[model samples]
Target: MTKLVLAADHGGFELKEIIKKFLAELGGYAVKDIGAYSAESVDYPEYGHKAAAAVASGQAERGIIFCGTGIGISIAANKTAGIRAANCVSEYMAEMSRSHNDANILALGGRIVEPELAKKIVKIWLDTPFAGGRHERRVKQIG
Candidate 1:
């Protein structure tokens, strides 16, 4: 089973809620919504770290992070060892993030993407598998 870990800051908290509901009921994956339970104006780094830790420790198979601009949270998640998190704004990039990099986490910009688009992106991301041939060596070197 694919275990997905999710977290967000105040800026993406609302979107995260919509995502959580969708994943639990319709996505056909195991989801763990870490926090930022409310849009109460908080820092993204803390939540990013928690989500990253889950992925890094193998507690979760993948992670989804949300922030005002996705850039910041993506940066934070990538800081943890063994995390190959990518911020994807398009369906192509979402697919590539998994196929080429074997990305363990996906980062989304709450203010930048719509709910339907986000859901679609998540589905695409989860469905793709790493190409894992010569790219395997490169991905291992990434961390």
Candidate 2:
């Protein structure tokens, strides 16, 4: 089964929970929630780092991080070496991030993206495989 690590701040807590259930219902993945746990205020960086670390360390094959706008959390995740967290607002971006960039983490805007659209993006990101011919060399240069 595929393993996924998830994290979110207070602004993203609700959506994160929803996505967790959605992934669980899919039945082929082991979803780990690294948390902000509740809708109370929390820092995005903390959760982002936790999830990114799990992915970078190979505890999870992939990670999904969330913030109010998806930008700050992704930036935080990217600070960790070996983690490529892509903040995707569209299905096309999600697919491209995985296929072209080989992103190990996907970042979503809990407040900006509707739950349905987020789900579609998640599905696309997870289903797409990295096209690692020329892209492999490019990804290697990313340090």
Candidate 3:
């Protein structure tokens, strides 16, 4: 099973739950949810940090973080040295994030994107392989 770490603040709680079930239905994914758990108020940075740490520490293959606009949470996740977190608003962005940036973590906007579109972005980001070659050199420079 693919180990997936998930985290979200109150702004993203509902979308996170939806995606959790979506991943479950897709099968072959073992989701570890470190979350706000409900639609109550909470800080995005804490959850984002937790999810990014999980990926950086090798406890999870990849991570998904969510916030109202996907900006704040992704910023937080990127603060973790080894994590490359991408806040993607479209399928193209998602694909490029993985292929060009080799992002280990994906961030989504709960309020900015619809659930179905977000799902598509997630699938594309997960499916796309890193292009390597020049991209590998560039990604290394990011560290």
Model 2 has an lDDT value of: 0.94
| Predicted candidate 1 versus true structure: per-residue lDDT over 11-123, tens digit per residue | 89988998898888775688998899998999999989999999999899899999988989999989998998899989999999999999999999999989999999988
Give model 2's clash tally.
0
Clashing pairs in 2: none
TM, every model: 0.96, 0.98, 0.98
Report the C-alpha lDDT of model 2 over 1-143, residue by residue, as the tens digit.
Answer: 99999999998888898899889887899999989899999999999899989998999999999999999999999999999999999999999999999999999999999999999999999999999999999999998
- Candidate 2 has its poorest 10 consecutive residues by lDDT at 18-27
Writing each residue's lDDT as its tens digit, candidate 3 over 50-94 gives: 999999999999999999999999999999989999999999999
Candidate 2, RMSD to the unseen true structure: 0.6
In candidate 2, residue 15 scores what lDDT? 86
